[model samples]
Target: MHPQDSPSNRPTPVSADTREANRRQDHFGSREAIWLFGYGSLIWKADFAYRARRPALIEGYARRFWQGSHDHRGTPEAPGRVATLIHQPGSRCLGMAYLIGPEVLAPLDLREKNGYLRERVTLHFLDNDLADNDQPDVDDPLDDDGLTTARTAEGLVYIAGDANPAYLGDASDDSIAEQIAHAHGPSGPNSDYLLHLADALHAMGGEDDHVFGLATALRRRMRQAATHPATTD
Candidate 1:
């Protein structure tokens, strides 16, 4: 764990809008097409076009529901939590990487404009046999050492760091679940996002304790809410 990423080493909140700064980054070099990583809603909801996609992982990061969503998943008055990567040395985060043309960045930037800044990362592809295109079984045990990486590609990923204004920071699992269960925005109920990501991770043969924990807590809260509805005065 890097000292900068320590749970208590949170930075001061800055501007939430990061579209312009992301556009200024010139890490793509001369490549006509580049890879983009999607660890959250992008895993299940691929609204944009992509040439190809594969299960991939990045090092030194772990997914957590610390970022607050005011535009898509919740309102300004009561924001919903969203997933973001926090540096955890030796930890690997599994996600999907899409091969896309450079032109795709414009719309992607807009969609993830809420505190998400484009970060250059090295994507380690999981499947060695990309030519076959056979999906990996979700039930199989994840053998990181036994797995052969087809290749590694430089890619861009959206990360909402602590500097962002919408960052909600760390919270207890029960507290995070409470916010997600009752929050709603244009995309829909915040619980839907949590549940969908849980399901997506299962389908992708990825195990995230934080995500699964929140999903379990959210389900329990939902059940209680269903059984004991608040009556109007």
Candidate 2:
């Protein structure tokens, strides 16, 4: 367990207004089910129960580790980095999508309370499989070329704004890896998050350059640490 895992290091409480804002902005009108796009920790540590899970792709965004984690992955003094989607034209992020019940809203909302805002996005499922029998069938939107587009569904994702206090903005891969390798919080070492995401992407026969590059640098740093243990006072 990491030092930040202590109860005292738990994340700050979510404001009532934030909760209400999420509820009000949710565009899942009268729908019995909701789709959620998971690009990072949700890939492996999705503690929340869900009905269906499938490979999905979202365009117009790139996964970046610019968000700072103060509770789950790090502390107030040295926050760990976490992945957040950044708007980038022509970029597509491959992730998983979950079909979940509405009751999950509150818990999900609180879990991502730190510097994250729930935003709606369109997900294109790679597989045609629909885990739920009652899920609605919607026509895929066509592009200008008149080609059949991937099956699409509207979903909510947690994204941190550049203006968020926890935002780290931009940094070199080595810099980010150094921070991740040394940071530990309630959840675990920050490097574990980066490596896990890279492994997940590899298993799916996909690649994310930014995540993989950081993971590579982090592994090298870990090797160095193992070879030269810190001296005791």
What TM-score, over all chains together, does every model reach?
A: 0.85, 0.82
* lDDT tens readout by residue for model 2, 1-233: 45345332234332312455566665566765677899999987789977567788899999999887877777777778899999999999999888776888888877777777888899888876553342333442222212222378778888887866677767788778877776788989888889999999998777789988888888988899999988999
Give all candidates' CA lDDT scores: 0.81, 0.76
**23-56, model 1: which lDDT tens digit per residue?**
8987657665677989999998889977567789
Q: For candidate 1, what is the lDDT? A: 0.81
Off by over 4 Å in 2: 1-20, 130-150
RMSD of 1: 8.2
Which RMSD values do the candidates have, in order? 8.2, 6.6
Q: Residue 125 in model 1: shift from native, Å? A: 0.8
By TM-score, who's the top model here? 1
